[model samples]
Target chain A: MTDTTARIPKLTRKGQATRDRILQAAVELIAERGVVGTSTEDVRKAARVSGSQIYHYFDSKQALIRAVITRQADAEPVPGRPMMGALDCFDALRAWADAAIQRQEENGCRGECSLGSLAGELGAADEDSRQDLSNGFLRWQGLLEQSLRAMRDRGDLRPDADLGELSLALLTALQGGTLLTQTMRDIRPLRAALNAALSYIHSFAADQR
Target chain B: MTDTTARIPKLTRKGQATRDRILQAAVELIAERGVVGTSTEDVRKAARVSGSQIYHYFDSKQALIRAVITRQADAEPVPGRPMMGALDCFDALRAWADAAIQRQEENGCRGECSLGSLAGELGAADEDSRQDLSNGFLRWQGLLEQSLRAMRDRGDLRPDADLGELSLALLTALQGGTLLTQTMRDIRPLRAALNAALSYIHSFAADQR
Candidate 1:
């Protein structure tokens, strides 16, 4: 949070709106065509702003992309997934998986700009973007850990269950499932992936005897 | 197979060598950068071939990328993964997972060009590329399915187990796990993902009664 806050330049309300417009345009463009495909000039035109205006908010393309990563991270786009927060129970986790699969199906399995996709594109070559993506995933993992810890406290999960590994597995299923869904143009991979992860979690369920 | 065969232009042995050089260069560049970042000129320079030579082999950048995808598919780069084949039993599956994690660890978790990464970059926007990627994953899935079927035939797994879903689940864990490993710069995610999928499969183990 401090890092993100410190990077933002002071701006009046109007300036903030202009910056948002530029950022939104960049996000859409980057989603459609990755970071390498999106140009500042393209963002400028998409935002309906002048070249100087884009420069006013972001000093360079790297800065703009970093800003996008920061925004995506802060937004908690993938794992938390907007309305699907507080995954503290097995039922909640199952619902989350269903929602993700349904959403992908609704979109015809077209891959969108999620943190995972961004990481897939940027994680290899760019060190800074990799760090940003790492942080984003860590934050998501923290949320899942909190939920698993809650389940453990509630005696829904076994006391000895490995919460960290469980959370990481769920996340891995998600990132991988979504990738396959995009590539295969089908929802079954995502469904199978999530079902396997969920069943794995269920394997660790408390005996309740 | 017929589609790929029809697309290849007839070439002399030297012409084939030149084409191979160009394709290899493009693969390296695309792996390091991405499909968008690697331009025709870059391929020309990297391959040490003239622009006319590149055009003689690949009529367009799209054609070159498609060729790469087809090559990657036929090679079965992700699931078969070069040396690891016939993942028909529990031991082979565990060994494959360990090797994957070790390989990622050796590379410092730098994401390499795999079918997954290429699909992540090109799957959404390009229909032709998306079809190519879809075929690649389907081929890998077929290999996994065959392995799982062998296990079933061997009475290692329950006859009731859904081999297709099981195979898809394993593939999802792999693709998702690899993506997370690349982003987080850690092998733990991959380890957990593979472990969970393996556990899921183990859950369906024969009663041995």
Candidate 2:
């Protein structure tokens, strides 16, 4: 992040809400039309913000895109549970998967995973953007690993199980399942992939945990 | 596909080679710059094709993208053997995973799965494009199922194993792993995901196949 991004001005309460509203609108527009298809004018019109307001909160379109990435990383919880942070237990993990799947369905599988779309389109496009995406994914996997490690400490997982590999595998299944679900517009692949992952994790559980 | 797509012109021997050249060039350009970033003029220059020639073969840019999807679908083989088609036996499946992993490393994970990038960018943008991408995924999955069913008939798999669900799970893992690999620029996640998937598949092998 540049100095400008670092100082994305925090506003007074009213101005902060306006900033958030623009970010949400940008996310929806980009999700619907793709980055190339969306323009600053489109976002300004959608958010009911003036062109100056967009420039005020975001240094440029890339900075705005980065903010969207930050917003997505913050969408970790579903309802009341910590989707990745508390995923050590089976029920918690299952609930997280359920929330992920339900979000895809409820959205009609239309918009890209706010962060995932950036990963695919921007992963290879630029160094800074790719690093941002990589960090986002690692942060997510770290949360998953924390929960799995918690399980291991509780005698829930085998001492021999590789938590690093397991966490990577689960996140991989998720990214792939989410991609397929988005492409095919069917929830089965995500459900199956996660089910297989849950079963694989269960195989490591000590006496069903 | 429109009538124009159905009748994408077949050419004389030299003409066919030129068409192939255009497609290969388009794939590279799009992979590097993205669909919206790449233009027909860029393809014409990259492939050394005349403007008239591009128009003669493809009706529009969307048509060219559709052809790219078809080209990607044809990239299923890892080596001399059919990768997904012969994924019935354990060694064959492992080799296929190894090949997929190697491809990511060899390519420096620069491009999203050609098919997957399109799926994310175009899946929800338009209906016709989504159908084309959906067909591409189903065809790939069908090849997977064929070999899996072959294994079942040969008594390699447990009688009760749900091949349909298993295949879906495997593909899901692959897509997820590939996505992570692309994002993180690390080969470990793809390797881990595929290994987990293969282990999950092995759990259903009769006498470990």
Candidate 3:
């Protein structure tokens, strides 16, 4: 976050609004039409910014895209969200799953995961985007791992369980679930995937029974 | 398969070879460049087909893309492969998981799922491509469900096991694993994802133990 803020020059309120406007426009259009399908002219017209205003703020489309990525990555975690904050507990795990699933449900299963959608589309061919997505996913997984580690430390999870692996598995399931949900236009796939993953994690919960 | 075969005209051996050549070229270029990135002229040049020849085979880039999707879908399952043929058994599941992981490994984690890759970029905006992807994923899931149902018939799995949901979960995990593997350029993500999912399925096995 600091890195992003530091990179951008100091701007007046109007300049900042213009930049925000451009990014917001990019987000909506790029999400729908994809990066290739959207052009600078479309962004400029949508944002009501002159061509020079765009160039002054963003040297190129790629720069603007990176900014959009940064914006999305930064906004992933909902502020003041208890569920995401307490994934270490089994109940919180369910809540986290609920939050994840409800996110898609709210969007009507559209663009299940914005960063994931971008990574799937462009990660295969573009090194920069791949790196961005890899970092983005790792950061997400890291949050899960941190909570799992907390669970382990608190004697809620098995000591021998591999937290890193478990976190990655959970993430994998979520991504798969969200993708299926969006494609099939059905919520069941995501629900099943998350449920299975949470069940697996609970399997390591010190065998409470 | 019958649907695809019926679309092409009855052709001589030479014509079949030409069609195969075009599809092969399209696969390579389109997988790497994506639909919007690769052009008809690029495919025409890559396939070494003249302008007239390109038009003779496909009406437009979209038609060629659909053909490519069909070709990839047809080749997804290994002919007479036990692992894919019998996803219900433990050994076969391992083999299938290995195959899925190894595919991405072989490509250095590039475009782990080509159909998925294309769908992510175009599916939300393009109805035809979305339908193609949805069908492709369903067919893949159907193969798993068929094997699971067979396993249940043989008492390999509990009758109460929701085979439909389980198959969906497995496919979801596989897709997630492959996507993470591709993005992170790592194998552990895929390994962990598939293992977790399979373990969940095994938990539903009739407890012979």
Candidate maximizing lDDT: 1
Give the DockQ of candidate 3: 0.75
lDDT of each: 0.82, 0.78, 0.79
Higher-scoring candidate on lDDT, 1 or 2: 1
The TM-scores of all predictions, comma-separated, are 0.91, 0.93, 0.93
Model 1 per-residue lDDT at A168: 90
Q: Top model by DockQ, which number? A: 3
For residues A11-121, write the lDDT of model 3, one tens digit per residue: 888988898999899989986777777888899999999999999888888888777777766665333355443577888888878887787788788762277777767
Write out the backbone clash pairs for model 3: none
Give the Å shift of residue B43 in candidate 1. Answer: 2.7
| CAPRI grade of model 2 | medium
Per-residue lDDT value at B13 in model 2: 83
Clashing pairs in 2: A176-B176
Query: Better model by DockQ, 1 or 3?
Result: 3
As for TM-score, the candidate ahead, 2 or 3, is 3
Over 4 Å off in model 2, which ranges?
A1-6, A77-82, B1-6, B77-82
Q: Give the Cα RMSD of candidate 2.
A: 2.7
Q: Native contacts recovered by candidate 3, as a share?
A: 0.76
Task: List residue ranges in candidate 1 displaced over 4 A.
Answer: A1-6, A78-85, B1-10, B78-85
Better of 1 and 2 by DockQ: 1
